[model samples]
Target chain A: MAKFSGVWATFEYLDEMSHAVEKIREKGKKPTVLSPCPRHEIDHALGEPQTRLPFISLFAGMLGCLTGYSFTAWTASDWVLPVSGKPIVAIPPFTIIGFELTILFTALFTLAGMVLLGVIDTLRHPLPPAVKKYTRFQRDRFGVVVDCDPAQTQDFEEIFKSYGAEEVHIENN
Target chain B: MSGTTFTYGKINDDMLRMLERPHPSYFLLLLGFLTALGLGVLSLAVQVNVGIGYSGINHPIAWGVYITNFVFWIGIGHAGTLISAVFYLTRAPWRTAIYRAAEAMTVFAVMTAGLFPLLHTGRPWLAYWLIPYPNQRMLWVNFKSPLAWDVFAVSTYMTVSILFFMIGLIPDIAILRDEAIRKGQKLRAMIFTPLSLFWRGTNYQWMHYMRAYLIYAAIATPLVFSVHSIVSWDFAMSSIPGWHTTIFAPYFVAGAIFSGLAMVMTVLIPVRVVFGLEDYITDHVVQSVCRVIIFTSIIVGYAYATEFFIGWYSGSPFEKAIFYFRPFGLMEEWTLTGEQSIGFPQIAFFLMVFCNVIAPIPLWRWKIRNNLVAVWIICGLINVGMWFERFNIVGSSLQREFLPAAWGSYWPTVVEFGITVGSFGFFFTLFSLFVKALPPMAIMELKEAAHPPMKKEAHG
Candidate 1:
């Protein structure tokens, strides 16, 4: 089992949360921030790199386009039903299916990418017990969970309280 | 501080309260919708058992009310994707308040629209034949046909719309899961937890979620244009006089958006009132949508005029005959009484023009557009008008074809009407359930848009 301990602090304001996150990081501890909505200031403070979901969508879209066109062409040729005296391999009309499937697959891949990546990222750093204590983190509250040594918990708690934390809790896992 | 009157906690409380508190009116309305849906199922059953002959469609006018309703519902679905996906891609902030319900409308409307083709097939049980799978018969789908394209387009649109809707719901569902956990609703928490994909609002999750949403938005934009264009081609690809025009694509698209915005208004107005979401949905949002309605209505009106002008200018007797017969049916002679003399097609044509054109003109005034009651009534008119427009196009054109001998009038049987009513009931029922279950407004998005509070001055 993954073992860790931390101090979770709930902030009423984004600026306060941002300050607390910076303070935790300055002390060389990894801090996780949670808020009801995505905040630019908090994100910048966390310094997480951009996700590769767009590239995944693009690759999936290209595959979808190829599959759409090739499947239609292969199927048409397999059962060579000449339609209305037109060519057996109709590229023009087949493009519609290709276009639609490209969008469909891109959307599907994007959803898959987001969910898989999100779930993996979350599982890697399990929810800290401190964060769990305040359900408002998923609602209105902005929170920072600092992974710190048990001996330093008091110092972190003072830092969070000075930064206008509404509540602070300690949890070990 | 965000300029919003609501705090994040307040939003959670307000939204979750809707689920916990069930007003008597909700049950009563649900009962009404369910009854309507039951009646629709009964009508469909009658058609299935007694044969599609129970419908008014026959001979030349083979596509009647069913096709009309199909196009109408499909058109209604367009505004949702347009407002949600297109507006999001363009970074329009106003979409935040309205897109959740609009996206839901897209899903339900498409669901309702998908049923018509099956219902019209006379043998709905074999509807699977429309799909192209490797079969022992060694036959392949005719990819050249617009009908085939329609199958692909509609299915793709439905899948993508549903995915987009579901993805947007994840964050809100996580909030609900948290709320349920706090309130000791274990069953609700159990259900919502997995659905939320264990969202913890971490920076990594937000990064991926935002990127995926942008990609989905980008892909969905073209889909809004293509699906209806393909649907229009189901008629335009034919050799039929009125349906064969090149203008059909743009005309259909504009009309689709026009009617779709109207439907969004129709659905949102009552929802805004019932849920008391006026502060978020706002009169400004309603007016902004009205502006879109006005623009699309003009395009539709122009398409209408161009169709008539082109018919008269083309000098083709067949085209002229169809165009003329639409507003003034079989002008050669009428021995019937005064009321009967004005035929069904003529009445449908006039109503289409009046509802689609004349009724929406009032939206030009800020006074009329700002009033919820007026907007609702106007949107209802546009909805009726758009249905008649489809009816006129499908019924009027086919009723009087190339040869006069083949010309015959058509009207929908009671079964067709019941099924149409049921489609509305079905749409409303799904919407009602959605409102009660999910946050009608996007809670996170609204919270994001709100103005943050100003920081207090630093103490000496």
Candidate 2:
């Protein structure tokens, strides 16, 4: 009997990999699909919820707009040195500043949100040693990791092999 | 191999191989650019030590080649964003193979453009005074000025462009890292490991990455227009006869994309041949850029016609006088030097017309656009024309001011020419290193656009 933490399956074909993922879900087990590139089919097979990254960008953009406008206006009013007979707080020109800040904050926040989510997921489920050993997931192969009892590793391996997985192995942590 | 048969392994093998050590000729190219940049630095040092008078700029023409180059480089950056962000949003398939290099161009071009202002100010160290920072002096920048708007617009554009470019490179860098690790190259792995940001290509990473990338495209699309619009406002907001026109914003935006696309082709065509990336950057990609140049050329031509019409129709003597001076101001006495020579304005105006409006027309013919040699020549001419376009806008108008007494023909000195050539050196040197250092093509996105390797062929 083999003592293992999980089972890893690698596939060269997107269709085979996606089908294997569907089978894992049908067996009431969660599996994470890995690939060199994002696939619409794999995304559909995973059935994950829509990402909330946009809301993060939107909120930050609004905050940035307020900050840009208020900062310019506050600094302008602080010195009341009117020039060219224009108002102390001009809205038209300041709108350009506000618009630029809105984009700047939106892009930065979106990137930060992505890094944060990636880090959180990485912390929760550290990559297995086998993943480090076999890096095809970052190059060409599509991979799925299924956690199961040590005794059931064979069963998962059989399921993966049946769905055209090129390699199946028991990953010990 | 055929396009449909391109597998993931082949894509990796092809792109990552570019990262290997380059030929000695690559270093020679880099050295050439560095030499140019050194000359520019020396000229700038001399100017700073002596005075700003080393350049052609004076009382009437306070803005000269530096401002022209500033606008030219900024305009050159626009097409990169347009290609990367705008094409992405539109789902243009051809963009995948080219967007990575284009985005890199945008960042480098903007960085090159940013240097002009610092150089022009003479006191580059005190350039921070333009920023709206809290200080003991309590001197706030005048918010009403277009120059103030430029500080925010350009800085924000630079920051956002860099972020966008870095985000796009994440997946590609991950591939490079993993390849290095697999090959047991300790040093390369060490360098790329952190740059990849620990991307393991999990479903979660892809989901969030795709969403965020789309949002970045959305935000950057507007910047493609706004940045150049703000740049044009530096001239438009002025009450000068030729600069104060409502058409300046759109006209400048169109010209920016036009010149930017030309520059992309100008670089990419040679790169494709030298790198032997004929499969990736194909004739189809070159043709697409040529078509865009044709469309933009028409808009630029129309804008030229409209400027002349408005000058004649508005009945403003100053506008008509400046418009006349642009193409017909050959009077030797009109020059500040008072030498018996042709003025720079007329020469630049006609050359601008010949290169920008006339040269690109042949691209409309499929045969000409497909010919790489012809396309390359046309692109080069467009670049030259766009620079003159800026020169015409900045120089000609300032030369023929409302009061002829205040008008002067600005002649560029060797130092100004050196600095101008040096800016190109700076851009090319950074870009030349970038091509060897990073994946010039978007590896992951190219795979996405291609057929996925399958047990069986599945076509969408």
Interface RMSD of 1: 1.6
Q: Against the true two-chain complex, what DockQ does each candidate achieve?
A: 0.69, 0.78
TM-score on 0 to 1 scale for chain A of candidate 1: 0.89
Q: Return the TM-scores of chain A for each candidate in numbered order.
A: 0.89, 0.91
> Distance (Å) between predicted and true CA of B276, model 1?
2.6
Cα error, residue B156 of model 2, in Å, equals 1.0
Which candidate has the top score in DockQ? 2
* Poorly placed runs, candidate 2 (over 4 Å): A1-4, B330-339, B457-460
Query: Model 1 chain A: which ten-residue window has the lowest total lDDT?
Result: A125-134
Over B1-460, each residue of candidate 2 has an lDDT whose tens digit, in order, gives 1344588889888998887899999999999999999988888888888888878889899999999999999999999899999999998778888899999999999999999998889788889988877899898898888998898889988998999999999988888888888889889889988998988898888989999999999999998899999999999999999999999999999999999999999999988988799899888899888998999999999999999999999899999999988998845445555565677777789899999999998898999988999999999999999999999999999888889878788889999998888899999999999999999999998888778987776744
Q: Which ten residues in a row have the lowest lDDT in candidate 1 chain B?
A: B451-460
Q: TM-score, B chain, candidate 1?
A: 0.96
Quality of candidate 1's docking, in CAPRI categories?
A: medium
| lDDT on C-alpha atoms for all candidate structures | 0.86, 0.89
